[model samples]
Target: MPVRNALEALTMRPTRFLLSSWPWRSLAYLTGGALIGITTIFAVLFLLAAGVVLSVLVIGVAGYLATVLSGVAVGRLERWRMRLVDRDELPNPHRHPGAPGLRAWLMCRLREQATWRELGYTMISALMLCWMDAAVVYAAAVVPTMLLFGPVYLYGETSLWIMIPVAACTPVALAVAAYPVTAWAGARAAMARALLAPRSDDSDAKLVELSRSRARLVDAFEVERRRIERDLHDGAQQRLVALSMQLGLARLELADGSPAATQVTAAQQLAKETLAELRELIRGVHPKVLTDRGLAAAVGDVAGHAPVPVDLDLRLTGRLPDAVEVTAYFVVVEALANVAKHSEATRAAVSAGVRGGRLHLDVRDDGRGGADPERGTGLTGLADRVAAVDGTVALSSPPGGPTLLHVEIPCAS
Candidate 1:
């Protein structure tokens, strides 16, 4: 069974929850909060003192920067501390640094809304939140513990008989109060996350931001692919050509029937094969024709290289976004590769066009069906990449022949 956190445990029956560790966790959370509150008090005072003293000198800017940095630390600390009662991950709202330098990072953090909100949390936590947490814990826990042991201390007193019965009911009373105690502590942590993390309005914005980041990553990946392709084409390919020519020259220098001449000929054949494989690798990286032309030509070129005969029918009005093109091209490549590797078919067909402002692709093969994405990462990866661009993939395969994979990606021509 999954262990319930404080908030989850609160939803259980009072008797069951009391038997769990939530009450103890609540107490510990409050105790830790109180300690952190005291630490924040000292930290704030130190920052203020340092700021004032440095302002008297000329380098007050450093002290102000340190204050902002302290707010960042407090925000991160609260995120960590919130795990005491919260089970959900709290995403940091701070933007990444645009450049690689301490000044840039500091400026980015200071400019974020989270930084100011964290500073407010630091103040509130120090002034009131921790005290409130401690009060609830004391009322729910410490008082009950004292009451449960009241008769032990009051033994032999005249009121011992009366206190004993009331003391025995402390367990029931504490269990009843444990619900609100757990709830209040959870609410406080939730409030801290609300203040120190990204606002809920930005949840959809996070998706858009994620899409843009993925696009940037794809662009960087394309750039790196082109760089590698250029290196192989210009460096290794040229050397292989040179080696093949030198071997041919050496063969000519020896007699036609000589053993050294035969060995040189075999070496020349090996060099040519290696050169062909290297060229294939370069094309797989990112074809030059794809960059110069578009996705139609790129898909056709890849289909041409497939061992199985492939028919290509791709039509487009014009160029699409680079990210869309790259994603579509790779998806087709992987699909065709899976077809050639797993599909026991003699032929495959690739068709692409745009419909209703969405690029449509269909790769069909006359192979035995039963392709399961759960069995392989190829289809799953393709679907994920397509979804990253607001696209969808549909696979139709049964226990018979002919499997069809259709993909639609939104793009403006």
Candidate 2:
């Protein structure tokens, strides 16, 4: 933290910086850097020697591991030295491995780019970084200390008076030198931040945001479809039904021999047929069964309509989230449709249940089973729809046999 205020002290009156302990803090910070640099040099030298000399003995493996660890060790020391000028904790950008163990940790570190960056920093520190620190300390603090104390060394000689003038200017020079030392510390900390911290969240954050956007779109589409369904059921379907009833009454009122009687009966039949077709369209848009009775009932109802005989066995505790339930229902429907159209199977089975916090659906048909997305079964579109809710669809249909489609969707109760 002392060095964190290093820049603040520099902006003050020159006399204030000289009077304060900032110059001493800068000196200590540089001295620590020199020590770390020396340690890095020796450790690197040792690893190189062991790696080359012990290569035949297979002990080079230990040397290789040590080389990687040394870089990380030096980086940590550099982070700690920031306390001389900085107070903020530097966060490591490396991710935790899914498993925990020494080998796993080593693999995690080795695979990260930061590990190589640290090694590069260590090389620079060992080569000339510490020399620069030591040079600054000598020019700014150490040299001045000796010059200010010269009078003590030459007390009995005429040189003492000459030393007095130099000593008088020593504090000013030292105060000015503190700026570079503090500047270097700031640069070092900035480098650590740049190389060690998370650069940007564009990759993971954008993916997550994209998924959420798709899910929202799906929900909105469902809402619009339901609205359309309601409109048709209440407005168009009801009117058509009333029109059919009026035509029937007209037919009954007309005499059996009247020319209008046959025409009225035909008009009634057409209206009835149109109303039935409209009802089916409304159901296809967004089924009422799904909204009212949940997924289990919805699946059973859908299965009952398939051309192929369907055996439905669905188990559940209660309703799932709207997004998951809707997505899963459509996936099952599409799979069954594909089965009916292509499988030519005499019988199909639908099984569903929730396990491991996910809704699972397994649809199978006993028939000709060479089905794929590339053949225009709509499997690709179905997969994308399921993916909107982070669900998956897998199809397994070998030639000339049974076809099995499995779908899984995450849903929390």
Best-performing candidate as measured by TM-score: 1
Which ranges of candidate 1 are over 4 A from the true structure?
Answer: 6-200, 384-390
Q: How well does candidate 1 score on lDDT at residue 234?
A: 91
Task: Write candidate 1's Cα lDDT for 1-413 as tens digits.
Answer: 55446677777776788888777777677778877887888887887778888897858767767766776787787787777777777888776776989989887777766778888888899899878877887777777787788888778774856987879889777877778788887778878876877875445556667888887777788789889989998999999999999999998899988899899999999999999999888887877778889999899889988989999888876888877888899988999998988888899999999888899999999998889999984999999989878899999988776899999999874
Q: lDDT of each prediction vs. the true structure?
A: 0.83, 0.79
Cα misplacement distance, residue 391 of candidate 2 (Å)? 0.3
Clashes of 1: 0
Clashes of each: 0, 3
Pairs that collide, model 2: 3-84, 3-85, 4-85
- Model 2 spans > 4 angstroms off: 1-201
TM-score per candidate, in order?
A: 0.67, 0.53
Query: How well does candidate 1 score on lDDT at residue 10?
Result: 74
Instruction: Kindly give the stretch of ten consecutive residues in candidate 1 with the minimal lDDT sum.
Output: 199-208
Cα-based lDDT at residue 235, candidate 2: 94
